[model samples]
Target: MSELFDRHQAVLPKWLAIYYSDPLEITHGEGRYVWGADGRRYLDFFGGILTTMTAHALPEVTKAIAEQAGKILHTSTVYLSRPMVELAEQVAELSGIPDARVFFTPSGTEANDAALLLATAYRGSNQILAMRNSYHGRSFSAVGITGNKGWAPTSLSPLKTLYVHGGMRSRGPFAHLPDDEFIAACVADLEDVLGQTRPGVAALIAEPVQGIGGFTSPPDGLYAAFREVLDRHGILWIADEVQTGWGRTGDHFWGWQAHAENGPPDLMTFAKGIGNGMSIGGVVARAEIMNCLDSNSISTFGGSPVTMAAGLANVAYLLENDLQGNARQVGGRLIERLRSGCAGLPGVREVRGRGLMIGIELVKPGTDEADPEGAAAVLEAAREGGLLIGKGGGHNTSALRVTPPLSLTQEEADEGAEILLRALGGG
Candidate 1:
């Protein structure tokens, strides 16, 4: 480790994981590339874990933030703010929830916490149903609902959370079953879990595509089937869209739309990519659910003028340019290329994803056993080839996460795939 890495370790918590055997300090970024402190430019495929929604250093977003900062940075959530209102209006319209209300927070962790608060309060229960191998956030309440053990440091929580099966379809009990039978089995599992729980179950929260759990997901309409059961008990469905939102999935604007059979989610939490790198997260809920809390609450730095301005500009750019269509077109090509390139690689187990949020799982050669070390080796090789990537999975970070900015072009996609293939030692 360099002096900077050594200093980072001295100051930061050990649990805050850093990538690679050696760490690089990224100083600046433009478009699809970022320069390290050593001044080497590397293609940014992960986009700061998909926080950079449109592009890096986008002129429109930068100008909006600068202009807003010049006027007023923040006025808290108490008094009215124009930029806040504008962004809120846009988000509410796109939320797909009827009579939707938006409350901004600083990060996805806080957004999930707020959703939990609202659901528990509205439904009058402290019990929550969460999907196994799922990850929400790092906060106390968020960790409580999170089912991924690697992310959850402590078991203590205010709510009673029960883990449900069928979140990750690849390595679960129903992985071998057909799509219809898999959904049925998962629904049956959910019914059994519900039967074991008390009547105080407030809501069931899920990630349409499990982000930190290696981008794994169950079949389409699985949640809709689960929704059928939750409806009988009045359990609200909360879609955690921290990673799956903003049309990154290609086919849908929101991840929950994959299960559109039961209609929109009762509550949805969004963060990460909305501000295009700024701290902006929020919960969208129907009027009655949002207005359930009787007392006043506020996020001290949430929805500030600067972040809201950035969000407005970023969202506008995303829509006007039709980046979602770009994701569908370019992402489809990239995944196809990857699938073709890594066909017989020894460690490569599966290549799966929708749109730009793709994952390539690695196993111990021909066995089903996870190979985290192999995944790490591939990461190191990709870095040497000047391509940046991320890794995550339920089994010790055993998969590569390839979530570039939604504005990723075909040429860039091909370049990244070539580098990744070389790193995997594929010919």
Candidate 2:
């Protein structure tokens, strides 16, 4: 172990310093727990930023990957692979997007980038409308739609993107308006922007439930109204489901499904939970929009048989066991427990989120501004108590993002909540 650590230390890249690493190196993971180099175990609540929905080292998914890897790995999309076709068919069927065409990519960033490019190509537009505080991805085109400035440094030129504040804070471009008025203003603002930059507006992209943007859920009727406006303007609505899709939200397989009654988007992008930690992503488009693309776009490693097999197995597990229902049940219990546990803690401001994708917002004692120190204390206490967690939101503000795997037991949820409550007490 010492020799292996020495080798890794010698070759590890300096760019990785941006991430905080624990001294106890992780050696293996199973279900919702990860074991360290010292063989100590810790309960994982973040689930690899909500990627490992079915859990780690899941038997069926592993077996599928191993079996497919032994038979075949890569075949360009020019030719067909059974796993790829099957996975695409399954995704389409589950999403209720009939005969929907799927395009594979190596990451969610690529998926979002492809969606943006396709929107531009289909509409011949160069401008995109995205929500403030939303995170799409890091690639150039995806970065253009991402509202976080921290993700803007990689772009060579300023992004041709328009931004609107979602319903959360009260002082932004769309503030000082009632919910109905705010939605109408947003739609009008978008139309005004498009008129000024006429014929160049490609698409309006947003997360159904904003993830990196502090887990903010928009007010009722917002998405439906936005869909109508986009349709009127001949613009496409792209649902960036990278972080919120694949049953993370509990009630729906896709985050947008939670809003399906409102209206569906033209294109949807997925990653994270679909592959269960395997690097795979895909775009599901309405037949008409997909057919317009002329087949010029292709990826070399997009839908390799091995990754597709893993995705198929993950989806199978989700369906066969009714994991989405489990997410709802377990997530409801966890949310209620969290809200009740931290209801009156000092420096704790709000508890919000749907299903298991919960967030506990920490604020300074007297100000609405974030309480980073209080958040750090809570995180430290939770870590010391043998639970692994993560933080998110702009300004590195206080949000303890809790998204445990679907397989996490109720007992584990109780323990996790108890630890979090104790951590809040420390703050």
What lDDT score goes with residue 273 in model 1?
93
Assess every candidate by TM-score.
0.99, 0.92
- Write down the lDDT of every candidate, Cα atoms only: 0.93, 0.79
Instruction: Identify the candidate with maximal TM-score.
Output: 1
* Candidate 1 structure lDDT: 0.93
The local lDDT score (0 to 100) that residue 382 gets in candidate 1 is 97
Steric overlap count per candidate: 0, 0
Model 2, C-alpha of 89: deviation from truth (Å): 0.8
Q: Write the per-residue lDDT of candidate 2 for residues 1-427, one digit (tens) a residue.
A: 3665567678996443221334446788999998867677889998777888898999999999999989988897878788888988888877667568888898999998888878877887677888877789777777767777655556453347877656354436666678788878877776677677756567888898777766776665677777776777787888888988878778777777755665667899999888998989988988877778776756889988899999999989988988878888888899999888777776777787877788788888877788767777777788778887777766465677888998777899999888888878832
lDDT of 2: 0.79
**Residue-level lDDT tens digits of model 1 in 389-415:** 999999988999999999998999999
